[model samples]
Target: MLRLVTTSLCLYCQRAQVTPLLLTRPHSVIFQEENQLAVNALYDLSVDISKVRKLKGWVLRQSAVYVSETAALLRDMGASGPVIARVLELHPEAILCNPDQMEAQKKLWMSVCASQKDLVGIIEKFPASFFTSSSDHDNQKANIAFFQTLHLNKRIISKLMASAPHSFSRPVKQNEEMIQTLQKTYLDLGGKEDNMKIWLQKLLTQNPYVLLKLPNALHDNLAFLRNVGFTSDELLRLLSKLKGFVTELNPESMRLTLSYSEETLGCTDAELRQIVLQCPALLYYSVPILADRFKGLLAAGVSMEQIMETPTVLELTTQIVQYRIQKLRSFGYDVRSGSLEVLNGTKKDFEMSYGKLRLRQERPLFNPVAPLRTED
Candidate 1:
C-alpha cells in the first residue's frame, strides 16, 4: 500500500513537472488529493455560505476540479458545513484512482506501461535496428554521394564544368555506356581514382564568379564531378564566385553566351567563357596543377582510364615505398637499417670487427716475452 502511494506521487510529480506553457494554456485547473492533510486544506479553503447570507447574491460558478480517489472524505461532518458541496462542485472527489492497483486486477490487460526493464529491452533492440556495417568501397561511394548531394555552391560546379566536359554533359541513352566510358577512362588512366576525382572537382569548382555567369554549369556537372573528389569548400567558393559574376554580367547576354551545347556535355560555350573570364585565380593553381598531374600520371605507364580510378602519385608513392620495403625485407635486406655489416666468429676477430663488439689492444701488458729475452 505504501509503495502504491509512492508510485502515485511519482507519477503526479512527473505530470506536474511539464512546462507551464502547456499547462497554462488550459482553461481550468485540476488536482488530485490522496493525503488527509490536503483534503483538510481544501475544506478550510471552502466558503461558509450560511454566514454570508447578507452578502449580495452572485451566481456561483461551477468548478471543474475532480478527484478519483478518497470519495469518503467529502462527508467530513466534524469540519466545515454545507459549503463542502460547493467545494465538491468546484473540486470533485474520486471514488478510486489508483490506476496501478486497478491494472493488476484486470487479467485481460497487458502491461500498459514501460518499465525500466522494458526500456532496456528497447535500447537493446536499437543496435539491431540502427547499427550496420559496410565495406570500405561502399563507404567511399557513400562519402562521394554525400558530398555531391550536399548544398554545394555554383563556384565549385563551374570549376568542374571547365575540366570534365564529357562527364558534365547531358545524360547518355544508356547508363552502361556511361559506366563503360568511366571504366574506359579509368582504365586509360591506369585506374587512378583520386587523380580523376581531383581533376574533375577542380573543373567543377573553377570559379564562383564564372558559375553565376553559367547558372546551369554546376547543376548539370555534379554527376561527373562526383566521380572526382569535389569538396564542400570548392563548392562554396564556386557559388560565391558565381554570385559575384551575376552582379557583373548582363543576364540576357549571359544567357545567350552560355546557351546549352550537347557536345560540351550540356555545358554552354558561355559557361566555358565565363569560367575562363573569371579563371585567373582559380586556374592559377587548380586547373594547371590538376592537368599536369593527370598528364604526368598518364605518361608514367598509367592509362588515362586507370588514372581516373587509381590513387594519386602521392598516395601511390607511399604505397610503393611500403611495397619496396616489403620486397627488400622479403629479399633478405635489413630494411630497418639499410646497410649490413659482417662480423668474424673468433673473440679477437669479432672484437676487432665494427659490429657487436669492440677491442682496444693494451701494449706492454704482454711484455712477458721481452722481459724474458732481457733476463736471458
Candidate 2:
C-alpha cells in the first residue's frame, strides 16, 4: 500500500510539474527498473538528461515503443537524434502520434524541400507546420494549390516554404481571397490592367511575402496613401516595385511623414509624389534618414532630377553609401558630381567596375624595356 501511494504521488508529480519526486531524489526512486529503462532510452536521445527527467512521464510512456520502433523509423528516415529530440520537445504530442503517421509527416515536408538540413531548419523554425494529422496535410495541399494558381516556379515555391514555413499552413480561402483582390487592385491602380500576369510576377519577385498582408488591410492602407496625395498611378507603381512598404508603413506614420516631407523638409508635393513613385520604400524610411539622403544628395552635387530618377540611391544604407562614395573618391572618380547611374548600379556591378580600377591603381608600374646585354 505504501509503494502504491508513493508510485501514484510520483506519477502525479511528473504529470503536474517540472520534476518528479523520484527524479529529485534519485536514490529514493523505488521504480529502478522503469527509471533505468527511461534514463538509458533518453540518454541516447541526445537531449540533456536533466531536461528529459522533467518529462519522465512522457519519456517513459513512449520509451518502450519509441526505443523499439518509432525512433528507429526516424533514424531510418535520416533525422539526427538532436533534431528528433527538438521536434519532441517542441511538439510532445508527437509522442502519442502513430509512428507510421509521424514518418509520413516527415516525408511530406521532405518532398517540399528535398534537403534534409532545410527540412530540419524549417522544423526548428516552425514545428507546428509539420503536424502529423490529416488536417495539416489538407492545409498544406491548399497552400500549394494557391501558389500554383499564381504560376510560380517550383524552386521559388520551395524557397518560400523554407523561408516562411507557415505559408503552407495558412487558411487557403483567406490567402486566395487576399491575393485575388490585391492583384485586381494592382491592375486597376498601377495601370497594368492590360498585363496583370506580368505585374503579379514582378510583385512576387520584389516581395515573396505577398500573402502576409490581407486584402482589406491593403485596401485600407492604400486608402490612407491616396488621402496623403498619392494618385492611383503613383500608388500602383510604388507598390509594384516596393512590395514591403505596405507591410511596413501604417497610415498614422505615413501621414506624419508626408507632413514632414512637404512642410518641414521643403519637398514640394510633386517632388514627394515623384520620390515615392520612384522609390515607394522611401515612404517607410524615417524622416531623419530621408532628410540625410536629401542633404547628402545636395552635398554630393546630385541633381534633383537624378535623385528622382534613381531613387534607389536613397535606399542604400548609411554605411554602404559612405564606403562606396569614399572608395570611388579614392579612385579619382567623383561619384557625387558624376552621373547618378554609377550610384544606382548594384553592388556586384559597382564592385566589378571599381574593383578593377582599384587593382590597376595598386599594380606596380613595370617597364617593358630590358637592360641591353652587352658581351661581358
- RMSD after CA superposition, every candidate: 26.6, 7.8
- Tens-digit lDDT track of model 1 for 100-198: 332221111112113333222321332111111111223323322333453334334323322332233223222224333433433343545555554
Residues 1-376, candidate 2: write the lDDT tens digits. Answer: 0011112111211333433234335556543233455445556676565654466445443322233344555566577877777765555434334445556667666656757666666666655555444445667777877777777765566566655556566778876786788777876785655577667666665676766776766787889988878888777777766764485567777777677666643578877777677666667877888788777666766667666667778888656777777778876878655666566567898788787767877898877796766997
The CA lDDT at 359 in model 2 is 84
> Which window of 10 residues has the lowest lDDT sum in candidate 2?
1-10
**Lowest-sum lDDT 10-residue window in model 1:** 56-65
How displaced is residue 122 in candidate 2, in Å? 6.1
In model 1, the runs with Cα more than 4 Å from the true position are: 1-20, 25-194, 200-376
Q: Candidate 2: deviation at residue 173, Å?
A: 2.2
Q: What lDDT would candidate 1 get against the real structure?
A: 0.31
Question: What TM-score does structure 2 among the candidates reach?
Answer: 0.64
- lDDT of the structure predicted as candidate 2: 0.63
Error of 2 at 215 (Å): 2.0
